[model samples]
Target: MNLTISVVLLAGIALAVVLRLKSATLTGAVIALLFGFYLADTDAAPTVNELVTAIADAVRGIGN
Candidate 1:
C-alpha cells in the first residue's frame, strides 16, 4: 500500500515533467491523496511532525 502510493506520487511527478502539463501533475497528486487513507498507516502526530520538519528544511534551503 505504501509502495503503491509512493509509486503513484513518483509517476505523477514524472508525468508532469515529461508531459509539461500542470493538470496532469495535479491529477496525480489527487490520486495519491485519495489512496492515501487506504494504502498507508500513520500516527497523526508523527506525520504532522515530519511534514513540519520537511517544510522547515525546504524553507531553510532557500537561503543557502
Candidate 2:
C-alpha cells in the first residue's frame, strides 16, 4: 500500500515536471492519466502492481 502511494506520488511529480517544461501538452497528459486510471481496473493491474513492486525492491537493494 505504501509503495503504491509512493509510486503514484513520484509519477505525479514527474508529470508536473514534464508539464512545466512543456514537454507534454495538457491534453496528452490528461489522456495518459485517463488511460492509466482505466488500465488499473483491468486484469493487467495485478501484473502491473507486481512489476512495480519488483522495481521498487530492486531500487531499495541498490541503496543498501
Candidate 3:
C-alpha cells in the first residue's frame, strides 16, 4: 500500500514536470489519465501492479 502511494506521487510529479515543460498537452494527459483509470479495473491491473512493485524493489535494492 505504501509503495502504491509512493509510485502514484512520483508519477504525479513527473506528469506535472512534463506539463510545465509543455512536452505533453493537457488533452493528452487527460486521455492518459482516463486510460489508466479504466485500465485499473481490468484483469491486467494485477500484472501491472506486480511489475511496478518488482521495479520499485529493484530500484531500492540498487542503493544497498
Candidate 4:
C-alpha cells in the first residue's frame, strides 16, 4: 500500500495497543481503508461501516 495508508494503519494500531484507546477491531477498519482506495471500482460505504464496528469495539474495550 501507499505510505499514507500504511502510516494511518500503524497509527491506529499504535493508538489501540500503546495508548489503550481504541480496540483490536480498529486495526481491521484501518486496513480495510486500503481496499476502498485500491478498488475504487467497488463501493466505499462498507469501509465506514467497518470503521463504526471498530469504534464500537474500542468503546466496549474501554468499559471492560
lDDT at residue 45 of model 1 (Cα atoms): 46
The whole-model lDDT of each prediction reads 0.60, 0.72, 0.72, 0.59
Q: State the RMSD for candidate 3.
A: 12.4
- Count of clashes in candidate 4: 0
How high is each candidate's TM-score? 0.34, 0.61, 0.63, 0.33
User: For candidate 4, lDDT tens digit of each residue in 13-42?
Assistant: 555553354444755565556544544444
Question: What is the C-alpha lDDT profile of model 1 across 3-60, one tens digit per residue?
Answer: 4446545644555554565455666666556445433444454776689899999999
The candidate 3 region of ten consecutive residues with least summed lDDT is 1-10
lDDT of 3 by residue, 10-40 (tens): 5556667666778777765875585577668
When 1 and 3 are scored with TM-score, the better candidate is 3
* Model 2 ranges off by over 4 Å: 1-23
TM-score, cand. 4 vs. native: 0.33
What shift in Å separates residue 58 of candidate 4 from its native position after superposition?
Answer: 0.4
Show where candidate 1 strays beyond 4 Å.
1-42
Q: Is candidate 3 or candidate 4 better by lDDT?
A: 3
User: Model 2 over residues 1-64: C-alpha lDDT tens digits?
Assistant: 3544444455556666776777767765875596577668768789999999999999999988
lDDT of 2 at 40: 84
